[model samples]
Target: MDKLMPQIESHIDFFLREKLPKSMPMVAMLIGDKTIGQIKEVFVSEISVLFPQLIGQYADGLLEDDRLYPMLTEKLQSAAVYSYISGTQSKLKGLFSKVKWGALVFGLIYGLLIGLIAA
Candidate 1:
């Protein structure tokens, strides 16, 4: 187990250097939570040669994928699942752009008035 650690690091380094064009961090950040979990599930198979020691960290990371996959699956009903997920931001951009500032202010004021009345 201990010996395989260096081998894993070397393999990852070689992949990052020779195969991946840019840093994985940038790519990973865009992949989202559920897809990341699927990646982990596939990569942790015995054929991948991942060490048992690093398994804890891998499992933890996979489990922490609580970002927004569940919400998107509600609409994905086609063959190009990966493409749909990869293009999530394109369709959902409107959701992030329209901020309910007035509603938020009104809600705050309403809450304050309610608190005052209760007091």
Candidate 2:
């Protein structure tokens, strides 16, 4: 049997190759176009050009399906939220070293107010 073709030739790079090695093999062979679309528009465009047959046939199941988009969007939004929250948590963790106990209480109140205002 022939070895499976690399999904995109002349285009793969180190960062993407790292992410892709973990992709489910069955899913990669089949609906991989829509899978790459979630990564970026550039990947979508490249897949369309490089592997039109597979991507075109499975496009709806992978790309246009309602279930897929919502999950992808939620993942994206939650990543952003988690990133910001982790940064804030790190800052707050460091704050404890600098303030006196009474001042820390005021600082916490001020931090909450600042967060509210920023949001």
Candidate 3:
């Protein structure tokens, strides 16, 4: 073998330089115009622009679907809600206590007037 490696390398180079083009003509559309780096940049920019809106919508959907009803129910069932109602009731009771005698007299007069009117 008289320097077989160099001969093989020369033939391979010749094939790549000449025959490859004939066998496969370069198609610009098939090998897209944009580079991998350019594509990655566009993808990153688009995601950055849309990510917040997407996350907001997703969070809203989760709140509507999974949290609203339970949250309302929890509030309705909470001791704080009952305490608030009881606080109002206790205030009314305190007011009524201060005016029980007057209120009773007023009620009796109001009832007698209504009964007289009816009769």
Best candidate (score: lDDT): 3
Tens-digit lDDT string for candidate 1 (1-119)? 65665575566545544445355666755665576456545544542554554687887886777854664565565448768776996766766555566578889999999999999
Of 1 and 3, the candidate ahead on TM-score is: 3
Question: Which lDDT tens digits does candidate 2 get at residues 22-112?
Answer: 6655544554556555565575466566665765769856876879989988898789787898899999877866666769789899999
Stretches of candidate 1 above 4 Å error? 1-79, 96-103
Task: Mark the 10 consecutive residues where model 2 has the least summed lDDT.
Answer: 1-10
Candidate 1 lDDT score at position 90: 74
Off by over 4 Å in 3: 1-34, 66-119
Model 1, position 111, has a per-residue lDDT of 100
Which stretches of candidate 2 lie above 4 Å from their native place? 1-51, 80-119
lDDT of 3 by residue, 9-109 (tens): 45554555456556766732243325433544564556556767898999889777966888878888786878899899999998988799788999999
lDDT of 1 at 109: 100
Give the C-alpha miss distance for residue 6 in model 1, angstroms: 42
User: Residue 69: error of model 2 in Å?
Assistant: 1.5
**Superior by lDDT: candidate 2 or candidate 3:** 3
